[model samples]
Target chain A: MAATRALIRRGARDLRLLAVPQCGIQADMLIGAGCVRGIEAAAVTMGELGGAPRFNAAVKAGAIEIRDSTCPAIHTALQASEKGVPFMPLRGILGTDILAHRPDWKVQDNPFAESGDPIVLLPAIRPDIALFHAPRADRAGNVWIGRRRELVTMAHAAARTLVTVEEIVEDDLLADEATAAGTLPGLYVSGVAEAPMGALPLALTEHYGADTDHLGEYARLARSAEGFAEYLQRHVLAQDVAA
Target chain B: MPVTRTELLIATIARLLEGCGHVAVGASSPIPGAGAFLARALGGDEMRVSVLGSRRHNFFTDGGRELFDCAAQGRMDAFFLGGGQIDGEGNINLVGVGDYPTLDVRWPGSFGSAYLYFLVPRVILFREEHSPRVLVPTVDFVSAPGVSEEGVWRRGGPHALLTGRCLFAFDRAARRFRLESAHPGESAESVAEATGFGYDAADPVPETAAPDRRMLDLIRGRVRDEIAETYPAFAAEVLGTAA
Candidate 1:
């Protein structure tokens, strides 16, 4: 709670919650409650985001606004914002349509330190704040990634980060030879919460449901020509300023 | 002699790999891994091959953490996937229940398909069963858009489809799937019978081969063992508890 409060204070107006493609529920909760005005997600377009019932309903009811960010990589790039590097290089997205509007997603000529090969480059991404769900965290904020390495890159790239985990353990968990290394080290993570099943709308391991039915509803609503307009009216338009 | 359903499925995948130049298979993707391994064991070593485990979110490499990064870098020529809902356009929705908020059911969701579908040059889709549940005229959601609304993808579309009883290829010119082949035991009539939409009977139908011993060896030996070591949960889920 302290972490969330501190993050909210730091964000003020400049804060934008950058979520991975998987952070569906967290986005839903924040957007639903009006804590955040807009969201940026990879793979899914803004049009797609507005289609979610919770998001769309919020949009329709005048609760929140939404935006689309392209590719999971771009979202990761934005998470990289804290690193201060201009960009990062990634493969397989080179020739796709995602490259057109994402001017930030540049292709650099490979310096090829080994052989001088001509390969494209991607820009580094660092976000102002990154919120992720994890299995465990220490009081100091070092985290265990376990099998899910979803947000490790973002940790290195983000200016600040907060993790909501299933449990908060001692720093010695990192000391055990059998234990996993610091996926998101205490140095990178500013705050930690023992928030299990925090990754809603999407599954956070076995503890929660993915809320797929809601996603289906969003899909149906998003596909209609006037769905976006209607959704915005119902979810984003009617909210009275929190009195 | 008619090939058993499992054999036929495996054989078709093996056949697809016969002369492919380069390929990458994903974890828990039984068909793709079996096919690629069979192709190599059968003297298609000239084709560069890699079996990438984990999703766009869970990237892994043998060289510890140094070589592994979550993003897919470089050009990927081919990939295979199977999911819950796929439409005529080949758009797939692995993210939800048929409906939202109050969903009928939930799936594991699209781990990497959304990104891989757009990035890979050729994507081969396979499913064990063909019916209204899996094959629909239109997808319920857009986990990955078959044809980007803006025509954004450069090299790949949903290039080809291999189902239990039929084969389909996306005619980029037409921007629709064209019937390419039907399994030996499955006549055009049977394949069409299972599909939600109708197609021309005159479409050229290719013959599907029976799963040979070599293909079985690939599954029992290389693919299954590797999966057991790398992704134990997935192997247990797909191969059953005894396996």
Candidate 2:
């Protein structure tokens, strides 16, 4: 179908994608679709994003981009874009050249009124769209970040927001009297897609089960250069053929 | 009482981590993980603590649960987080900006700050720097909501800040930051002098505890080794090894 072709083509464009480590299913889909390279994500608990297979392959094949800061790293990138700043400085990675290698990121001098040494500055980040999986949402677009609000920072830093939720509630359910504060109001969000089990490999809190084996498989595939390239060819660029 | 920077950072984290039941730590978070382990060793009743990261087995104990999920679900009591740049309000940045129109500033990646910041009841922030670069009056971008000026998060907001030269805590009632403690070996005057912003100096401040043998051993031996082995950056700092 022409529509399908265009959709695939659009996704194939090279651009930055801020991905959650647990979202391996999306990673598979993206790789299979040839959307992006392997991955360029932050993983605090690397064990959760499958094993060295996927990680190694992505890195070896140059399919993935790695950073030390993790999700907060991606969020900071978006923050720079949203705030129109250059770079923000951080402390955890200071004695190392992690910042230096990331030439795109500038460690700015402290702009505060007083200081002795030079300070690092992190630039603001603004993503095209921040995608997330939610437990509940209202037709009006009000969404509950649920018990795990992993997507909150992404939402704040993203230029636009898209969410796939398990359930849809009444618009009134999003109110303070009805629901507690910390709920994601409707104004900031756009395009609410009802995607059940969307948080696949990534746990969906109390609702769904994670695809652990699948994550492991992905890890295996991404661990080595040859493996990663083969994986991308079969999973991402190859035509979807009947098994 | 004069205290080392490491000790001051640890003590502040220990107090904020006092009542927590379970905490999930990253491989790289030495200060927080060590402090948590010490709290337990010091006869703190909270037993459900674990050191988890990318390589350790069963790191995904809860099926790819967000790192902050345990705290959010009442399963964890406390945790620690770091940032590339921290604002006066305690929001962090870890990503980069581009070269020209928007130079591409690369972020190491985000681990779990998003979920942790929103859900963890007692989220202690630790950064090794105390100058203006590390601590800004206004964050270039807020990767995580510190106070939720617009009311985004319900549970945590950078409760305590442990830095290279000082220690701080948030006044829950006022929702404003207060000086909770000063690191040993340093005076309020030195800390205030080093920091770019101002805090309520009139508030009472506590002294950080010295690092006991047990605590130091665990930190230098257990926590440090694990982190150094897992990440390339920490090998030298934690393990005293060459890359």
Candidate 3:
């Protein structure tokens, strides 16, 4: 998350962010600080901290383009890219308004089915870059993501993948059979940065819980444009100087 | 028995979820999530409830893709969705109000709402704020249409809409919503006044059932604790549980 923030701070403009719901503080921060120009995800919220104030404010102000996506659509799109497919046929979404809004999405008659039912076809999503925070990484760039396999999919689907981790272990993650299943091979990792507490305010699963009080404060402070600027200046910008 | 509006809404939703083998509640939906948990507790081991972001409640190992895959395969029986604006015809607008591309009010884009609404057999549209402003005549943008075109291969759509003022059952045949019952201290007339769209109302509408002592006990006890794992502040504020 911090690694992505650094990219945004370096004026990576008009970048599209893809993330799972409840894990999009970096995206929110990018949008709030005027870095992101578009986003594609299922949902983006503070998760018990309250609503996503910055994201919501940005949307209300019409400052960014958003592709309202669901978990499956994103996964399917990435899967299509991973498999080198132009599009993937999905079972549901024929009746959804989601299909209506997405001009790129198409409905086609089931080519193999006898019922002649329609199916939703989602285009492949090959992002320019995928950035995330992991629990640990090795010197060889193998990131140990544990059960967060979505990171692997993001790496496979995106042109490049960057990650921040708590620590850099000397041991080969793949040498341990138990850990190999959870490791994203260094082949897919573009860069690795060491940033302990990178996913603060958001949890790193077994490592530490989210800073709910701080997130609550963020939610409250980001409710208005002025407050949001103050929040960005205090938390993100100030933290940049300290880092 | 005295029942708060939140309890009544939960109880009403629980009743709507009767006999479902599995129910999936999305993020930021504490009421439905709690209700599903209550139903699971009442129904015993056979019942499965997956609340997104909850380690104890969710069984998905592959991240966000699992839920959509489960729903598509007919493994999920019920789900809940909310929108910024829901029309009489069951069309939900999660994308902002007014024109698209450049809008007067831009909401967080429509997530996988339309997709799930098409596959999940029992999609309950839920919103706490039931006013004319929200329950509009026609949604400015349809994030998910209430009914699909004939032969669109849709197996699931909206079953009912639960709100603070009343309960509305969706008629797939008519593609319109009908007032089922009103909450205590609210009448059909009040619901009509609050709703922007026309609906078929039952003559002499009954008051929505209150949560009984047993149900209330489960809600405030086990259900509250389980939901708190995913929605800490909501569980604390709504159910008086420790975060």
Candidate 4:
């Protein structure tokens, strides 16, 4: 989230943010700050912060293009990209209005199945950059996300991957058999930056829990544009002074 | 015995989840999560629950991908979904209140509701607020349709819609909601007044039953403790359980 705040502060624009629900504070922050032009993901929520106030406001104002999606669709699209496939066939979306709104998605008769049932096919998602914050990273740039394997998929599917970590560990993550399974090889990682408490207000598994009070404050302050700007000024802008 | 509205909803949902082998509850769904936990406790060790954000409750090792894979393979039996606006045809609007691109109100984008609504055998649509505005005649946007075209292969859809006023069972064949029963102190007429959509009601609709002593005991004790691990505030506020 800190990295994303920096990105917004630096005036990154026209970014397409993709992430699963309740785990997209960066996306919500970006949208709220007008740094994002499009979003493709399941949902963007602040967990106990009530909702993504800025993202919700922007959507209502028609300031951003939203590709309303599900977690599986995003995962499948990433999987398709990982496998170098043009599209991936999924079974669950045939009757839903998701297919109706997503003109890019298509329904086709299953040629492989004897039943001749219709299936939904989702185009691969190859993002320009996949950015995330992790608990730790090695000197070699391999990130130790532990059970958070979605980061690996994101790194694999995107053209470039940028990461921020709480600390740069001295040991190689891949050297330990137990940690190797959870490590994302440096090959997929394009850049690494050290940013402690990067996922603050959003919990990093095994590291720390979300700061509910701060998140609740953010939810309250982000209800309107002025409130959101105030939040940005107080939290994001005041960071340097606090540091 | 006197029962709270929150307890009533949880107990009602538990009854709805009678024989589900595996139930998955999303984040910010304390009622459904508690209900699933209660059902699991009552139904024995056969039942399994995967609540997002809980390390103990969630069994997914590969993050978001496993949930979808399980659902597609028909391994998951039940799931819960909510909408900003739900229509007579079982269409849910989670994107916003008004037309697309621009809207009067915007909730979070559709999470995985569209995908899970099609794959899970029994998808319980829930909303604590039951008003004409929420229970609309037609959703402004169709995040997920209740039924599909003839050739579309859909294994699952809406099983029931549970609101603060009553429970409405969805008939996939008719593509309409049928009034099952009204909550205590709520009459069919009162429900009708509150609801914008038309639903078929029984000649003498009975009042929803209160939670049995056993269910209440379980919910207040074990279920509350279990849910607190994921939703501490909800458990604290609703169940009066210390976080």
Model 1 root mean square deviation, Cα atoms: 9.5
Q: Tens-digit lDDT track for model 3 on A1-243? A: 677557655766777677653345677778877788887766776655645777877776778887776667888999999999999988766655456667888888888888778788899999888778898988899999887778888899889998889999999999998999999999999998889998887778888987878777778887787887887777766664423
Candidate with more favorable, higher TM-score: 2 or 3: 3
Q: Which portions of model 4 miss their true places by more than 4 Å?
A: A21-24, A114-116, A241-243
Q: If the candidates were sorted by their TM-score against the true structure, best first, what order would they fall in?
A: 4, 3, 1, 2
Worst 10 residues of 1 chain A by lDDT: A43-52
lDDT of 4 by residue, A200-241 (tens): 888888889888788877788888889888989998876773
Error of 3 at B46 (Å): 2.0
Best by DockQ: 4
Worst 10 residues of 2 chain B by lDDT: B97-106
- Candidate 1: docking tier: incorrect
Model 1 lDDT, residue A110, Cα: 62
> lDDT values of the candidates?
0.57, 0.56, 0.82, 0.85
TM-score for each candidate, following the candidate numbering: 0.57, 0.49, 0.91, 0.95
Deviation in Å, model 3, residue B171 alpha carbon: 1.9
State which candidate, 3 or 4, has the greater DockQ: 4
- Residue B142 alpha-carbon offset, candidate 4, angstroms: 0.6
Q: Runs in model 3 with CA error above 4 Å?
A: A20-23, A47-63, A95-97, A114-116, A220-229, A239-243, B241-243
Give DockQ: model 4: 0.67
Interface RMSD of each: 9.3, 11.3, 2.7, 1.9
Score chain B of candidate 2 by TM-score: 0.75
| Top-scoring candidate (lDDT) | 4
Candidate 3, residue A195: how far the Cα is off, in Å = 0.7
